[model samples]
Target: MGLFNKFFKGPEIDQAKSDANRSKMRACFDQAVENGTEYKLAAGYTEDVSRFNYGLVHGSKSKIGSLIVGWNEQNETIVVVPTTPDLDECSNPVYYRRSEIYKAYRNKYPTDAFIIYPDKKGYIAINIFEWLEDESNYIYIDQEAEAKAFTDFFMNHFKTK
Candidate 1:
């Protein structure tokens, strides 16, 4: 019975860990937003696209950290908070305004801006660009439904004027 269950279930979801991570993310978001209203939040592993490779030089994906993205309604901004395993090494929260996000969405070079697509490992990759620095990063979500929800929330807010 144990073997059968293991085979059928694959692996059990770690509810406790998930809850803890969510709490940490909420705290970070609150600190960044202050009194702003939250529209959406999603958790995933993040990587800098520039440093990522296809396993030729190094690994296919170089994960910098785990992160949670939150949409702040009060200031019309998107806040990304790093929930890296190594707390001391975590980067600061990055804020992207609605206008800047929209500009990236409508960029002349589509590959140079915000885009979401499936990764080689069956995860969903959401790419976000920092226009000023010309840098791009990606968040890889394990669940397709969650990725869709995140993308939908982002598009609804930042895809238009």
Candidate 2:
């Protein structure tokens, strides 16, 4: 079993998923290469460990960000570079606190949505995919304009490959 499968629990490695890689949800391994940013699937880059994080290879020196997305097809995965990291927006408390793509949905949808609050460790109770479910409150901000101010702030500083 894959590391993510152990926790995330989704489709297993198979041919159908392999064929899915050609679709909108290309794996991170491909997007990082396309964006000209440094990165690899699953591995984050480190000075001592080059192979560990291929994504960080050609990454920006100023920004630290990552987006673990799923290429539902073929069950492959893609990791886009987010506009910015959460901590960087710390100066603006409100932005850092409740500023997420889901906010846009909350502003639009009329319901008591279940907002997943970060815990004491600064990590949410689940993986990033938890925020990507369609029925769930998760929001995917693809367009720069669609992003909230906080997201825009991060995007402004970080360069997409």
Candidate 3:
């Protein structure tokens, strides 16, 4: 019975392993920032931390950016990395102000859409609209619970008036 149990047991969650992976991912992102490269974290990289792969933004397609969600000492911080081709090498990274986020919500369709200001004609809405129109624009988060949690955290942190 012991042998059968051992053989059939699922993989145990190891704290040490999870910590090591987090450290490695952080280092990689830090290095990318230092080098000023276009580095968007892959979905797999955030699987352990449960960060939503896609980030919603506002503005025209030519003047758009990506929101890079990261953990700092267990606190979630989001940084916007511009994608415009006109951006020079010297432009500093833009970090989202928690106060500026008007609203956050999740939409369920063919693929889950974790949205920020889905309606309400604000500057942020344009980006959400664009992302919604383009099927390929959003990132694929593997776990539904993780996706919901990510949206919840964002909404909780930046409460809408």
Candidate 4:
């Protein structure tokens, strides 16, 4: 079996069980909130960023910007709402070029690694693993876990690690 299969290889979740997990996710988001930040679902959150929007030298024409739903360490999940916006505020949302903030973070971090595509309806594989394992930095997976639930079904509905 593959990684995804192994992860969810257990029995398929029944509707009731799935619904319950969904509810748990919902409650998790109710508690967390981001005060001020330009968040947009992104494009090319794939393992390989060489793809469109990601592989491009610029981002204006690329698709980015997603909705954040919930994130919590206690529950071990990051919730987000998948989005397909016409623009990405993080960048030129309009032109899709690299924004000041994006550049800063990308420069500061070793690599602009991402696990989730905040803009799309799926979990983005960000540098959470690095954040957790690396001693140089303290990555708080919990910070985003609660936010996962608040996101739409696309971002929500995920298994715990």
Candidate 5:
């Protein structure tokens, strides 16, 4: 069954389980004093080098901003939340099913590399633009190790999707 296991796949995860996990996580987050800081997955994240000045390129209109990439247990999809102030305050977070991610890679900068993916939007540009001086451009996947962990988990999870 080793070959079959490699070619085939396991059954889909149960929706009930996903919902229960989401509920539990949400409860913990709600009870925390600092919800924003308490989300340890992305504590001191700043930017993704691959997303540098993406909006400045052609075929782009929307300015890039902050991003929060995390797993949404309730929906069983990757959630990309825009944290830029004022710009996307009224906008809803973007959800990407495993099938929606066309490609995923880690582009290297001078000393760091970051995860990048493309969806319906042009490119997954994080913290590449700012309209105001004090606008936020933080990414939760901060360090190279963290980025690698996220990339590995994401790639493995969607390898068959």
Candidate 6:
């Protein structure tokens, strides 16, 4: 029974590691909101969509590190901070302003911007068009609810009638 469980069960969740990651994400979020006028609305983890696969193959994402998304109200910007698996280190934050995102969302080629594939097993890809360098630089959000929240927040606050 023990052997069967060991083989069938998934890897155990490391509570300490999870907590550390959360703390690191929070710190990144805090830094983005350093200005008293800026505040965070939503945050979530993200993965870098592979340059070649684009989820067409099994290994379509580089899961080596994760990114933390932070929303700042003052500047209407989304800051993405990349971090290592253990959250011990982080790179510079990438800022995406509302005007730029809104423009991308309203792009002529709808598929060239934000895309949520209903048949793609809840895969949500955010493509900032030229801002992202190329089509292969899409940011993948794993959680559907978080993705929806991010879209909703952007629309509710920045979308013009």
- State the lDDT of candidate 1 residue by residue for 69-161, as single tens digits: 666555667666665542223356667776544242323353323343222233223443211111123222233455566566666766552
Alpha carbon lDDT of each predicted model: 0.50, 0.26, 0.37, 0.30, 0.41, 0.48
TM-score of 2: 0.18
Q: lDDT tens digits, residues 54-150, model 2? A: 6656532322233322121121222233322221111111112232222211111332221222333332111232122221122232222212322
Q: Where does candidate 5 have its weakest 10-residue lDDT segment?
A: 126-135
* Model 5 Cα lDDT, one tens digit per residue, 41-153: 32122343343354656442434454444553333355555443322231244555666766554454632333445554554532221112332443212134544555555
Q: If both were scored by TM-score, which would come out higher, candidate 1 or candidate 2?
A: 1
- By TM-score, the best candidate is 1
Candidate 3 matches the true fold with a TM-score of: 0.35
Estimate candidate 3's alpha-carbon lDDT, on a 0 to 1 scale. Answer: 0.37
Each prediction's TM-score against the native?
Answer: 0.55, 0.18, 0.35, 0.23, 0.39, 0.46
lDDT by residue (1-161, candidate 3, tens digit) is 99999999865544564345334444445543553233333222111112343458433323223233332213344443322211121124444445455565444553344444533563331122111112133222222343344455555664454
Off by over 4 Å in 5: 1-64, 72-76, 85-90, 110-121, 126-149, 158-161
Candidate 1 error regions (>4 Å): 1-6, 36-39, 49-61, 73-75, 86-90, 105-146
Encode model 6's per-residue lDDT on 51-129: one tens digit a residue: 5555665555463334556666556766666655444456777666666543323222524334323232443344321
**In candidate 3, where is summed lDDT lowest over 10 consecutive residues?**
126-135
lDDT by residue for model 4 over 31-75, one digit each (tens)? 232421223221222122333345646543333333323334334
Q: List residue ranges in candidate 3 displaced over 4 A.
A: 1-24, 32-68, 71-77, 80-94, 117-149, 159-161
When 1 and 6 are scored with lDDT, the better candidate is 1
